[model samples]
Target: MSLELANYEAQAREAVKMFWGNREAALAKQVASGNQDAGTRGAVTAGKNMDGFLALAQSLVSANGLAMADIHVQRRVLTLPGFFRPTKLWDMLVIYRGQLVAALEFKSQVGPSFGNNFNNRSEEAIGTAHDLWTAYREGAFGEDSARPFLGWVMLVEDCPASRSAVRDTEPHFPVFPEFKGASYSTRYDLLCKKLVQEGLYTSAAFLSSPRTAAGDGAYTHLSELTSLKTFVTDFSAHIAAVAAR
Candidate 1:
């Protein structure tokens, strides 16, 4: 099966839009009725719903090129020998060309800037990478395998916040008690560096293309907008890349 980048982008866009529309409708009802709690809960519920939609989207994208029966999306924790620590993750797992190819972590945000939620997501990605690395080192991978796994951070760029967040400036996440004094971006960068240096990741690329310098008085586009159609197309190419790995 081949990945369809355009379709992926379209589906992602539609799903997000639908999720937001539903949220807004509910919020409007609550506001008219003066239900503050409902509005508040609606915000949280919207995020959860988006997450669920993304989870399913990952599966759909994976299923097209790969056998749905063989491949698993959102694989849970499977304890490996000698690596006793358990960390459960919901990753889009691909079994391409008879080999485990990639594990994707889809992230969608309205704004460019990442808030507390982004911190959690970064932690999840880093932790999942660690677990996979440990498993591979302990001979957990199947025969005819690609030992190193790939990681992806997919974004739906719509809000100004997200635009500001992914700018060329140094990225930083807010600090929590667990991270002590380090910025979230600092921590995330360090983790990514270590993983890449250790040969855990193949190579890193952002789906959103950075704006380029066009001619005089013009701006170049950097990050590419991801829609359902785009996602399917990108998925096709990504699958091919993983197979070559």
Candidate 2:
């Protein structure tokens, strides 16, 4: 792994761990103080997973020497002038370089199969894309050059050992109400298809081995996965090269 990759990974790991520490402490206190929901235990675990995803996403970008536009970006559009106005909000908008380069929604899961989880995420991405497209059309996003947009659904690998811990107290993990029981593979497949349809992502591929090349529709594993660091390094370089062009 390159020094840049290693540094980003370390930073990401620490940030995620800190996020979890604070979140878990809060939840635990709630439980200890008798204000906890049994169902919330699952949700807590899911939150940890989300922390990991967020950290990784940040790391992925930072490894390329890119910083998010701001930690928190909420841009709104109000249609109509006064009483009949409707407002639209965009969550966690980010910028890379001087251009509006990227946007992402992070997700996490602790289950064997995605089942409906996939659908909900897919729908969310679709809606986000729709909103972005609408905003672009309405001139809310400005008319410089077209920027890249993306949706990400990060999942925790479901190994046999972690399943019981994940399911003991929580009946269902946090799933989008609409997309219950959807498989991860299915979700990824559909998302990739939609991204292609909308011209958002050029390609997707599964990372079978550390040596796997980035290709069309590839789904890379996160754990024990070789070459991920290398892949990110290359990805960062590629993005920089593209931005230069």
Candidate 3:
């Protein structure tokens, strides 16, 4: 039987539109209250910018035969045990039949400050995956349990700064060839691809959209490997396989 993808392409475009639209709304709300956060923090702190993607994920689980799965999105119920830390909170968690079906992280980055934020995001992604896998290996979820689908989805603002070549200082040694002259978007593409290649996440997606995307819901996938289509297809397949079992 074919995997059910839940019409994710259209949902993803709508999600992209919501992402930008929500950010703008959040920023405006804060400014109206005379409590605007510095830089893009206002949009982020207001939260729910990625709820559209969350809805898509929920739909995929239901369409693929996990309608009864406990999809946790609330902060109080999102904590999972960690190896290095006592607990880690995920953006979403799927549990079914007393087993963890999946855990996913949804993140976004916007500029005037891509350089530092990129490094921070990279470190956080790597560390989070390592921590989760180590905890899983230690039976954090349950004994003799199948590995759950772990996914990461990142949305970045597409603009001149993020798309331009980033120069790095090579004081001691050269950086990796692939990263030497890559733009932020290219770097995120590499990050997502490598996360899957190293078995850190079952699938990772990289998407970019301009501020203007709020009007028409336009977005771009940096590469086929990290595209939203690939992410949703893999996720839907995993959900179907879990249901089969």
Which residue pairs overlap in candidate 3's backbone?
A: none
RMSD of 2: 9.8
Q: C-alpha displacement of 241 in model 1, angstroms?
A: 6.9
Q: Is 2 or 3 the stronger prediction by TM-score?
A: 3
Q: What lDDT tens digits, residue by residue, belong to model 2 across residues 62-150? A: 55545433333333521211111233343334454444455545444434444466557567656556666565556554567465544
The number of clashing residue pairs in each candidate reads 51, 20, 0
**Model number with the top TM-score:** 3
**Whose TM-score is higher: candidate 1's or candidate 2's?**
2
Q: Least lDDT summed over 10 consecutive residues: which range in candidate 3?
A: 1-10
Cα deviation of 89, candidate 2, in Å: 5.3
Question: Where is model 3 more than 4 Å wrong at Cα?
Answer: 1-6
Residue by residue across 1-245, what tens digits does model 1's lDDT show?
A: 43334344444445455545555565666677776463246543434434434554455545444444244543353222224465445445555554556555655433334566566765665666667777766666664466534654443333344444232333596544434544334334444444445665543223322112111111112222222243344455565455444
- TM-score winner between candidates 1 and 3: 3
- Cα RMSD (Å) per model? 8.7, 9.8, 1.3
